[model samples]
Structures are given as structure tokens and as C-alpha cells.
Target: MTSNVNIDAHQHYWDPARGDYGWLTPDMPPLYRAFGPGDLAPLRTAAGVQRTVVVQAAPTVEETRYLLDLARGDDSIAGVVGWVPLDSLDAASILDELAREPKFKAVRPMLQDLPDDTWIAHAPREDAIERLIDLDLAFDALIFARHVPSLIEFVERYPNLRVVVDHGAKPPIRDGIDAGWQPWADGIAQLAKLPQKLHCKLSGLATEARKNWTEETLKPYVAHLLEHFGAARLMWGSDWPVLNMNGDYAAWHGAARNLTSHLENAEQDAIFGANARAFYRL
Candidate 1:
């Protein structure tokens, strides 16, 4: 409804036949359905979102290539943050391959499902992250509350690597739980000292909170990130098909706009799109 240009910082487009999305089950009817760029265009236009950064939902390079190809065919997708085996010995070569495509903006390792204490412990993952930095690629930390400490350590060690905390560290809000989120908030505050190296997406809170979360229910989490990271380092995201777990594209977009209603026009512009554009180099 506002005049500010919007950008969806965190959204996904997937094809089940191409990759394994074991997470999407029949019980999850809304998300188990198909989604594509054509499906997103009307939503984008209705939400006033001029551009989007398509993120990878799968766990393989072939999936990454698929997202890149989608970006190649869709100009509305300003950039793409896909997956790559950061622990692989050929990590640098994979980076080289993706670098050829300007739309390939960053990489994410699905660490949320990994064991609490894995090889990404400290030493090995730190080295791998450094290699990512050497190649000038950004890293998206997709972890839950238990993994926040490791994420903090990684960000501290690789101060130069651009790290965006997806889903506000995926807080357990649906259960009305905030105890586990306090430490995550503390970790984000500490990482915020690195400025551009740290950013956060104001998405996913709706699904995390009550199923039909109104603006009031989702305000606290959004306010926390806005206060901690500020609009300059914060970006708006639809979370798309994942958001379908709670509601549709209109619901998510409406929630986002409602949360930012109190901000100034310029501040809203930064959070809605400008920050994402600058962060992903779109």
C-alpha cells in the first residue's frame, strides 16, 4: 500500500521431480502443491514487490543450477542464493562455476537438520567459510536456536563474510516459546557489530507464531530484529511456499506491511528492498 519499492529477500521456487523435498508431506497440503515464477508474478505485483532474491530449497548442486536457470529466465528474480557443498574439496571450483552466472549471489548450507555438534563445529567449518569469503560469496546461516552459538563463532571468525540470519534464527514461536530465542537475540546483537556482514530477514514469523497470526502476534519478533539490526541491515521476505504452511502470499505480504506500518517511508524502503539489493549485490 505504501509507495516504497519492495523486494522479497527470501523466497523459493522448486520442482519436486527435480529434487527431493521430503519435508513437503500430504499433511502439509498448502505447500505440497506446485509453485513457479508465473505463480509469483501476481503476488509480487499485488504486494508492490518490484524484485525478488530466489533462494534454494534443495540440498544439491543440480538444485542450485535449477534455481540459477530460473533466475536466468525471470528478470523479476534479481538474484539467487543457492546451495553448494561448502565442505567439499572442490568448493572453490564450484564457486568458480557459479560465479559465471551473475544471478548466483550467495550459498547456503542446510545446517538446521544437522546434529547439534557436527564437523561444522569450529575449526573445519571456519576454514570452509574462509574459502567462501576468498571467493567473495555470501553465506546464509540457516540454523535453529541450538545452533546459534556455532553461528556466532563462525561470524566472529569470518568477519569479512556476509552472513544473513534467515528466519530470525528460526525461533519457536508457534508454541509461544521465547526462552530459546533470548540467546539467539543476544547472538544477533553481538554479530550486528560487523555491520554489513550481518543482516536478517523479517519473514517466517507468521508461521512460527500462531497459525493465523495477526499483526499484534507477529509484532514483537519483527520489532526485535528491526531494533537489533535496523532497517539498513534488515530485509523483507515472503518465505513463499513455506509461508503457505500458515497462509497464502497475500497473508504474508499483508503481515509484513502491517509490521512496518509505523516506520518512516525511507526506512520502509530500506527494509523492503534497498537493503536486499545492496546485500546481494543485485
Candidate 2:
């Protein structure tokens, strides 16, 4: 918890040649190319980011292994949030296989792409969450605002679950609409009430915003997260590579730093690094 330590708790690196990313289309030039530790190393260094938690982008377990392999060679990567098949009854074995990897701290099932919003609550899925809890693995929720209610319910179902809502649950930033704001805020506040278990990441906000976004336009939404989650539960992440679609790593980190410059240095330390270290045992 030293003041100077900094960790980017969420980021991604993918090579289409290694595993297919169904969502990664050729038109998206920013993401079409492969990214690895070499690309991120200097960006983080310039931004004073000393450690990172690389989360998964592709749904395949092969991709998870790909990332684990990358982590095996990269010391800056403290841990990883890789994917696993939560719908199948064999989830326990898959988790067992994954947990054998020392840096595997969590699982993100890619709920946003699925048709059923409450899929996490159905059948073997709930059992899968219990497995995650039993194995001491965190659950990274890659959801949108619409999934907020079910996400809240899912978390409530497991009091011991450690949850981090990726991308502010993906607010309605593209249209600059406030209609989704209230529900997102309300659900987030409800989740934040689970002080010990629930956490939020300050990331992927710019991409959700309009193509030409500014800190002022994003301040209202970011501030609300800071308000409810507090410094200890709020972690700053570049969401790098994906962040390249909206802005560069340095710009995103600079914006996050500026957004919270009003807070005390210790609180800044938590948002920028300490919280991530404690949350993921990084």
C-alpha cells in the first residue's frame, strides 16, 4: 500500500493468429493488430504504471492459455482474469485446470455478448460462481447497463463473491444520454454497498463516450463511481489496447489522474494502484 506503487488492473493483448476474436473485425483498425507486453511496457512506464492485471478479450480457453503464456514471460503482469466455460457442468474441472496457474485470479464469462441477460443466474452458471468462490477466484463482470439488475442479483446470491464491474457497466456514453445514468448509478450504489466484496474499475470510459471525448464530458459519470465506490474500492485501469480505439494509454492515465487530482494523495494512491494490489492479491 505504499503511495508510489501503481497498477493497471485491467488491460488486454490479443493476436488473431493465436485465437479467433469473433468481435474483432477488420474494419476496427485500432484493434485489428496484435498487441503484447512489448507494446504496453513503454506506455505504462511513461505513465508510471509499474504493474498490470491483463484481462481476457476472447471467450476461448485457448486465449486464456495464450495470455497465461504471455504472463509467464512478463513480470509486470501481476495476474490475469481469463475466461472459462461457466455454462457447462465441467466448469469445476476447467476452473481446477485454470487455478493451477498461480496468476489466475478471476474469470470473466463475457456476459455482454450472450442473449440471456440473466444467464449467470441459470443452471450450472450459479454453481460455476460457487466454484469460483470456493476456489478463491474473483468474478470480472463484463456487462452493460442493462445487465446491472441481474448483476446485482447475481452478486447478492453469493455473499462471498469478489466482483469487479468492468467499464462502469458500460454506461450510455455514446449518445451522451442521462436516461441510463440513474439506473446505472442506483444499481452501482446498491452493489457498492457490498463494501468488502464489490469493486469498480475506472476504465474503458473514453471508448464508451463519443469519438471526440473530453474529461469534462466524462467527469459526471466518473465522479459518481468515485462517490459510491470510494477510493479503496475504485481501481484505475487503462483498458489498454482496447483503449487504443478511443485514445492512447498515456492519455487515458493522464485523464484519470486529472479527474482525481482533487482527492488526497493516499486516495489517489488507492485508485491508481493499491486497491488493485489488495483486491487481486497482486
The count of residue-pair clashes in candidate 2 stands at: 0
**TM-score on alpha carbons, each prediction:** 0.91, 0.95
Residue-level lDDT tens digits of model 2 in 1-282:
354689998999899776469999889998888899999999999998888999999988889999899889989889999999888878888999999999999999899999898877664466677888888999898887778778777777788988898987888777665665766777777778863568999988987887768888789888999998888788998888988888888878888999999999999999999988888877
* Top of the candidates by lDDT: 2
The TM-score leader among the candidates is 2
**Tens digits of per-residue lDDT for model 1 on 135-189?**
6778787877677667776677667988888888777777664554566666667
In model 1, pairs of residues that clash are: 174-208
Worst 10 residues of 1 by lDDT: 117-126
For model 2, the run of ten residues with the poorest summed lDDT: 119-128
Q: Evaluate residue 82 in candidate 1 and report its C-alpha lDDT on the 0 to 100 scale.
A: 83
lDDT of 2 at 232: 79
